[model samples]
Target: MKLRILGCSGGIGGDRRTTSILIDEDILIDCGTGVGNLSVEEMRKLRHVFLTHTHLDHIATLPLLVDTLFNDLHDRPLVIHALEESMEIIKQHIFNWQIWPDFFELPDKSRPSIEFQAMSAGETRELQGRTIEMIPVNHSVPGVGYRIQNDTGSFAFSGDTTTNDTLWEVLNRHDGLDMLVIECAFSNSEKQLSDLAGHYCPETLIADMSKLRHRPRVFITHLKPGEEDQTFQEITEGLRGFDVVRLHSEDHFQL
Candidate 1:
């Protein structure tokens, strides 16, 4: 399995893009503004998109992606997978004709350009050659993290979550996890704001991470633009025995 960092920031501006990861070539973990960096040729190659939540930063580029590649998707269709609530938000708020031309209805309603498939947490769905499972996580909205595995190895992404029990337990339940991509959105100094926003700071993340049974190479992602320096510094000092690295846009990993 190959993973590419499309965008991995808490907010957008400059070169910072919100969270979006391309798995192999067919699967996308999230569809943020970072997705715009991909050309029409690259967007055409995408078949499946898995969203973390309904937040604009995470799902912002999805509607545009459909509109940009609508005419070219002759036999190819994009499947947007997430919880039912997330699906509803996209349909009602984003593609409801007011905000954007409902591309799913365009080129004809009989054969839509996009499809929404709702997934329940803990439900394992097969995509390409791997098994992808959604796990519930603590967030402001109905959010979920995912664990994806092929025959070679498995990788888990904790999408926009704060300290919680279910996330730690599910990760420990899985025997061998190659990489763990978790978020530390703010610094330890901003613990109050972090908690209110339902994201993790360094201290909170460290406390929760201590419960994990496996020691995978932990990569920190989703730091706010201005807070990047301090948050990365804190994560480096906090997580010992785990190879910690802050994710950058061009980084790639194969498992």
Candidate 2:
């Protein structure tokens, strides 16, 4: 499986995009602003979108993507897999008629351009030759992280989380965890804010990393815009004996 980092920033500016990861050509882990860069043909190739939560930064481009593909999607609706709570919030706030035409009910409710399939924590779904598992995570809103595995290798994504044991526990259960795309959204100086906001500062993230039994190549993501350097520096200084690297747009990992 090829995992492409379309965006991995907490906020966007210049070359930075939000948090969207494209798994090969068919699946998108999150539909953040980075998806906006895809061409019309690339957008049409999307078949599935898995969301972590309803946060704007994580789902900002979903509505637009549906709109862009509305006509083309009549025959085959875009499948959205997300937590029930996250799906509810998206229906109420995002895809609602007020915010954006509820694409689920547009054209025709019987066969709309989009579909929502609720996925619970610990549930695993296999598509093609890959397995996508949802694991609960600590966040302000109902959130989850995903662990995807194929014949070649496995990778885990911590959507947006703070210090949480569930994610590590689940990851530890599986061997051959090749990569872990975890988030460190704040600097060490903003440790308090990071805790309250359900995000990880460098210190907290490194502390939690100790819980992981497997030694996957750690890729840090979702660093807050202006504080990226400070957060990366702190992780480098404090995160000992781990293969950690900061993620950026256009970075591709072949697992």
The prediction achieving the highest TM-score against the true structure is 2
* Alpha carbon lDDT at 185, candidate 2: 93
TM-score for each candidate, following the candidate numbering: 0.97, 0.99
> What lDDT tens digits, residue by residue, belong to model 1 across residues 121-223?
9888897679999999999999999999998989999999898999888889988899999999999999999999999999999999899989988989999
Tens digits of per-residue lDDT for model 2 on 29-102? 99999998789999999999999998999999999999999999898999999999899899999888889999
Worst 10 residues of 2 by lDDT: 172-181
So what's the TM-score on candidate 2? 0.99
Worst 10 residues of 1 by lDDT: 68-77
- As for candidate 1, its clashing pairs are none
Angstrom error of the Cα, residue 9, model 1: value is 0.7
